[model samples]
Target: MADRDSLIADFLSRTAWAGARRAPLAGDASNRRYERLTDPATGRTAVLMDAPPVKGEDVRPFVRIAQFLRGAGLSAPEIFAEDTVYGFLLLEDLGDDLFARVLERRPDLENSLYEAGIDVLAALHAVDPPDLPSYDPALMSELAALAFDKYRSGVVGDANDGIRAEFVARFRQLLEHAATPERPVLIQRDYHAENLLWLPERSGPARVGLLDFQDAMLGHPAYDLVSLLQDARRDVPPAIETAMIDRFVTRTGADRAAFLPAYAVLGAQRNLRILGVFARLGMEHGKPHYVDLIPRVWRLLQHDLDHPALDPVATLLRAALPEPTPDNLQRLKRQ
Candidate 1:
């Protein structure tokens, strides 16, 4: 704690707003923390990201991806100053109009806000993607298995190793055959309402400000779309989801038939991963509030499983993974 505080102090001392007043900001699921820096004299505000390297957090990727998004004419926060070695970044404050909050205040703007986000994706896909690790079928399937390995085991008794192995084998084959797109594009693995901000004054794609994309990877285009629609944090109306999917397909000139199934496959993969991740957060990481969101994640996973393209492993998933009933969710929280 002492070292981190000193490092933060040293990092700020070298920046333009050396004596800025700092107020803590709500952090995400990662080890990183953030603070809003207010210039005492001018009331100018900026964000300070404190990502400690010892805790497995890195700021380099955020810096790289932020610059890339800005160069592409989107609204990723501008880097005001950085200390990559100590993992601190002084960033332009994009303000507090997150999509989730905006929709809460003005429910009527849901469609337009969602459309702007879809447009950003379309514009990004049209360009050559950055050099990054691939979110390939093999890696995705391993992550999907977290539903069985973590959630199922935590809720029920430990999952049978044989059953878990059998599911992973089948699921991997399903993803390899059905989910692999011929050409992959950059996917902000966590794109969703909460990570998006409504910047109405900015025109076109810039109207949607991006955040939390340091873990970006090269993956199927449907991957991020699934992240946006099947979000774990909040409910997106079915009408809005359908319309946005159609809009993305139309704008990108993708065949609806091929895209729908891939969309379903990736949706299932992502929701399954979320199920495990949420459970693990409570069971192991002491953040039990995440367990409260499991029922919603389960509902989203079921929606994805209904698509015929997911038939190969859907039955096994249904059989092996217990539903997030009130009792089962309580079990996870107790762990």
Candidate 2:
């Protein structure tokens, strides 16, 4: 494939591409491949995505959500064209800069970046959305089940499957207690720094461009916030996280009396799910980068659980994790 210089030309000819060449880009969690195309016709560069739907890499939802989001004045990648069945997409190029890259260069920019992210999220949540298939209750249940299947699948040791049972039972209790707001909104499920591209143009309100939004859904608002504040790849400063939350509260004008507890509970719920996923990725998917994040994620999980606002979940994980010991995790990691 490396020697196949004409592959891009052939693909473009097959797709009637106006681009000069195709440059492949790396991906995560999906079998789909991406190539940046420089089309001469219309003098526009677009992204060419090849998703083998047979391999469960459908691109329709991404298309639909992007359309709907753009209608709402958001800067989702615009679709230039598509081949639905074969799973090919021509998308408006959003430049090479990503939010992760922005943060790496300017640590002092976090405050503004986080504020802009939260503001956009608030607008999305304020849409008074139409009914759409959501992952609210579904995700809550699935996360519990995942903890059992992945974490307690005899992978982490003394805990075993029994620990899964305990976690699920407690998770159920937490879900039923917190649940979600009946008023749902389109959730950019993976709206973290990495999925955001910093585009200063058309950047007045939406300072960042959205990516990997095929997983968008009508769901809980806090889920996305948790993803940002407790980012998997970066440690968002505590002050930054607090300021973002405050800005969200102020912009929405939601009752403070109700916001803190629910946010804490959702934060706790989400981190627990991520913990299981981290372990599962290492043991099942053979991915080690996710494994390294386990300790940091564990600390975040405990930090949220320990919050008085989320006393119940905090109590549960504290009981589950116990007095921290090198041996406990070392032995548990074996399971």
Candidate 3:
């Protein structure tokens, strides 16, 4: 810890924010920690990202994607200074107007804020993506299995490995069949309200500030849209979700028939992955609070499964995983 502090001090010392006052910021599920750095004299502020390399966190993907998004006219933070080797970055502080916070304070602005965010996705999808790994069926299927392996297994003594293998094989087939493999768009895997900032002063899609995009990968356009609408952290009103889906389809000229199914599949895949992740975070990582969010995630999963496109896999999931009842939730927390 002392060595890390010295590294942070030295990194800031060489930069324009030398001797800046620092205050810790709330971190996400990842190992990365952030701090707000304020210049004592000028009062200017920048965000300090302290991603320890020892924890297997890398800053290169973030730097690369931030530059790409900014170049594409979106509001990804500007990189002020970086120490790739030590995994520290001085970034533009986009401020406290996160979409979730703004909506909580001013519920009336919900529609406009959500619309702008959807517009950003449309704009991003219109362009050709940079070189990045594909969030392919194989990878996605593997991740979705975490639902059975972690969440289900943790809740109900043990899951049948044989059933898990069968589900994954069938789920992968569904994914492969539904996906438009030829047309891939850059998807910010965690593109939801919590990661979005409402910068109303800026015009068009630029009004939405982007964050937590280091895991961006090439996937179906509907993937990020699912992440946006079926959020686990906060409830996006059903009316708003429907209207935004219409808005995105209109803007992007996507076939409603083809798009809706892909949206459902992606949502199912993402929510299933979250179930496993939340369970693992509580049971193994000692972050039990995430277990409280399981009910919302389970609701979203059920909604996704109700879609006719997921009929084949829905029964399998339902039979395999137990419901997140109050008792089941307690079981997770107790772990």
The 10-residue segment of model 2 with minimum total lDDT is 1-10
Q: After superposition, how far is residue 246 of candidate 2 from its true place, in Å?
A: 0.4
lDDT for 298 (candidate 1): 92
Residue 162 in candidate 2 has what lDDT? 62
Off by over 4 Å in 3: none
Instruction: Name the Cα RMSD for model 2.
Output: 3.6
Model 1, span 1-335: residue lDDT tens: 55988999998899887899999999999999999999999999999999999899889999999999999999999999999888999999999999999999999999999999999999999888899999988898889888988899998778678877887788788888777888889999999999999999999999999999999999999999999998899999999999999999999998888899999999999999999999999999999999999999999999988999999888988998998888999998898
Off by over 4 Å in 1: none
Error of 2 at 23 (Å): 1.1
TM per candidate comes to 0.98, 0.86, 0.98
Judged by TM-score relative to the true structure, which candidate is superior, 1 or 2? 1
Question: What would the TM-score be for candidate 3 when compared with the true structure?
Answer: 0.98
Ranking by lDDT: 3, 1, 2
Q: By the lDDT metric, which is better: model 1 or model 2? A: 1
lDDT of 2 by residue, 191-298 (tens): 889888877676654777888878777776677888889887788889988888889889877666666666777777777677668667766666756666667766
